[model samples]
Target: MIRLSMMMGRTAAWVACLVLGLGAAVQAGTVDVYSNNVGGDAVVGASPTVAIGSSGWYYSDVRVGGTAGIDSTFARSGNGSVLFQGDASAGSYKADVSYSTGESLGKLSDLSSFSYDWYRSAASTNNGIQAPSLRLLLGVDGVYKGALVFEPYYSLTTPGDVATDTWVHSNIFDPNMYLWSNKDLPFQEQFNHDIAFWKSEIGNYDILGVSSGIGSGWYGTSIAAVDNIHFGFGEGPGTTYNFEVGAVPEPASVVSFLIAGGFGLAGAAYRRRRAR
Candidate 1:
């Protein structure tokens, strides 16, 4: 009887460890957030086209000629990517897609990771390696605050530092590695101000949304695509917006899959214990 009780206690401890491990694993991995290709076709619109997901990502072209949409031709990984294109002929053309949903909004210090894959076409009439840029919009409610912008043109490497005609993966999570503009002044590009700086300066401001695209007098006839927008904030699991060309699994489907996997893992662990 004593030996059986000891074995039961050990098994309970092992099961507890397994459960904790599973929880950690779930929190660590990236879950699918949103997609561009919906209902087997590419969609584009001016000033707010919804990407298919519960996450509520939307594409917008603030200017008349600028446009943002799903492009099947220039994908970074999957069969599709979000494309931003505009000509300087239109006044300050700016096109972008943004996520203003709950998963994105939070205090500045709560951001743990932020990154995206961007592409610049060689055919871009822009003089240098012009590409789509990334932005973190800061504000509260519906009010407008300044944004933190990231552009590859600031790099001292090449015509733009980033290679054209191919996808460039950027890791902007580290404030030390990437330069960001406060966008307080027109075309005001500066660096070294990290998230901590923003927190100190504008303690009341919070992250309103995230955006990626090109234009606003960037150059003439620019073309770019963005994909795999991965980010984590507000104590939630990380999410990757895989802009793809096919049907993506629903959130419910993902949850069911995780639950099934957990059961399988637990069963395997139980069998191992029995063998022991």
Candidate 2:
């Protein structure tokens, strides 16, 4: 009887360890970053000038005069950095670029959620004002054919005053508010719209696009810096099973364990009755 109880305890402990190990595997997540450079311009699907800063960070320069019409662009820095700075124009100076990872990973689907810390220099009257805007775009085959635009909640018009780099988190799931109220649909809807638009415009091709430009304008008036751009599929932190992992255990294993435990307890009870 003592040996049987010890065996049962060991079995239970082993089962618990296995369950914990499997749980950890399922909860794993991954992050990747792409730095915009001149040589690898094709990687991002658009050709933009590359600028190497003194800090050793490669920046994509899309000046308003360039073929791609970007003043300057930098997605990820050399150290896997997430800081970005650029200028935009209301009329002519616009930086349109896209980053793609191709496919989704289960429920994490594509980057359905995005959060970034950003701030803009006050808009300048002489060198154009920087009323910075934020936009999220989706890419397919390296092209940004469309986007879902987010309006500028904070505008900086004062010179030398820095806009606070507050972390802003947004989920592109509210279609009614995003599309109807803001005159723009959610990210998924925007993607669908671009697909139909592309079918009509380019015929039989998948639509690759973005969420929208945060600060859009002409004349290099809109200057802004952004950092910590995080993209993920499910909800951002603090929710049950928000980022759950792996498959459930086999039903047979669970049933077998239950039956075995019950039998062991019954045997122990019978022994006690016989002794009494």
Candidate 3:
């Protein structure tokens, strides 16, 4: 019939363009940004693709000299960046129960947004700056417990302040989620604790942490810079692709859901041959 259905719709459009050109040369969720200036000093797992062995990051504070290296004089795009000395410590029991900017990023998957690129450097005295609230921390099944409690920017005025040309972007998932509370709004004005016990145990947490929680700590030696750090986003907005964050659709996101259901069933069989 009709030339055998136009040779079976051109052999299923050449097998969906050869499986979307081998799924764009086998690309799959891979993101890690320590600014790559090469973790020179700041010990404690001195990065190696960031996380594979040496515990990517950890520093609960009290001024252990608040460190974390690699910062070739500030970068917002690349080449180098991620120097967060912010010294200002206090650990007697809560000036920073300790958290030199906690990091572990292992098994990271689910993310629609987590951007980064915050630089503040009027040079020193900005100390171990953090207090503006910033905790994402998770570990679901592995159990580091969960947390969202946000706020990294509201800027009474100068967003990301200081200056190095102000590299502030920090999104961290829309309007800053939030789920740590005495009822919320920052559990009795700032962190009394009990955040609904990990937002009712949300799972699939492939380990991650990004604290600043339990405020009023560090803010003296100043100098922050972090860089282009990104996590997947987009299976929508102008679409590029995104799915990572397992517990389900693995296998290259099931070949991106069978290449988006074979182009949505070839656009519904070419609109049923223009409605006959």
Candidate 4:
């Protein structure tokens, strides 16, 4: 009976060690991009600029024929308004907000997954016509690297079109179907394009740029407004780090697990000897 009790104690100790080791191994990281707080406010400038609104939201502006190269007008009902407006020209423009190396919530070194919530509004005339949709780009260092273009199936018609607001989540690691079309083109072609873009554009950069106004032909005498831009990393589709747990296992955990396993085996052997 004494031998059995000793064996049981040994077994329990081994199991406890294993559990503790595994628990230690569990580590995680997170990256959150929001309009109101953090350093995510907006890149400051005239026309093609960003700022925080009285409502505590970030606004971006795109202007026409401005030094900022943005041909859009940005406005807001509150203290902050980043405008993207122009005088009925048809071209493409880009704007960006960058998070420095360690500013992100989780200090995500690698962009794993990304998601955002945005609201869109148009100057009441282009209801039936298709206006250019906003495209999201991820940059590294200071270069225009990779892009995640989202084309809304819906059209912008009126100002303050609250219905157009929605949350979009995507994995950076997965294939972006919205950017590539699969018809007669082979699947590999799309993959290659993405690879090239990511490698050249986002491979080692830390900045994230939000670009709008692509394609040609603009609806006459109208404007578009976007607000509440949010980017979340580590929890979404392609986010690298695991926000729920941590991105990778700590070194200590691996060592602990091995030690625990050794203890368990040793305890088992001791029990067998005692039984004999």
TM-score of 1: 0.68
Q: In model 1, what is the error at residue 208, expressed in angstroms?
A: 1.1
CA shift of 67, model 1, Å: 2.0
Error of 3 at 186 (Å): 48
Supply candidate 2's per-residue lDDT for 137: 40
Write candidate 2's Cα lDDT for 83-121 as tens digits.
Answer: 223333224443333333344221213334444444444
Q: lDDT per residue, candidate 3, 94-127, as tens digits?
A: 2121122244444334344554456666655543
Q: Estimate each model's TM-score.
A: 0.68, 0.37, 0.26, 0.35
Residue lDDT tens for model 1, 191-241: 555555655666466778888888876657777789888777766667777
Off by over 4 Å in 3: 1-75, 78-122, 126-220, 226-251, 254-258, 265-267
Of the candidates numbered 1 and 4, which has the greater TM-score value?
1
Best by TM-score: 1
Q: lDDT of each prediction vs. the true structure?
A: 0.67, 0.36, 0.42, 0.37
**lDDT at 8 for candidate 2?**
65
Q: Locate the minimum summed-lDDT window of 10 residues in model 2.
A: 238-247
Model 2 spans > 4 angstroms off:
1-61, 65-91, 102-112, 123-132, 136-145, 154-216, 235-276
* Candidate 4 ranges with C-alpha deviation above 4 Å: 1-61, 65-86, 89-113, 117-123, 126-134, 139-142, 154-177, 180-207, 211-219, 235-276
Q: Name model 1 segments beyond 4 Å from true.
A: 1-28, 33-53, 88-91, 102-104, 140-142, 155-161, 175-189, 234-237, 248-276
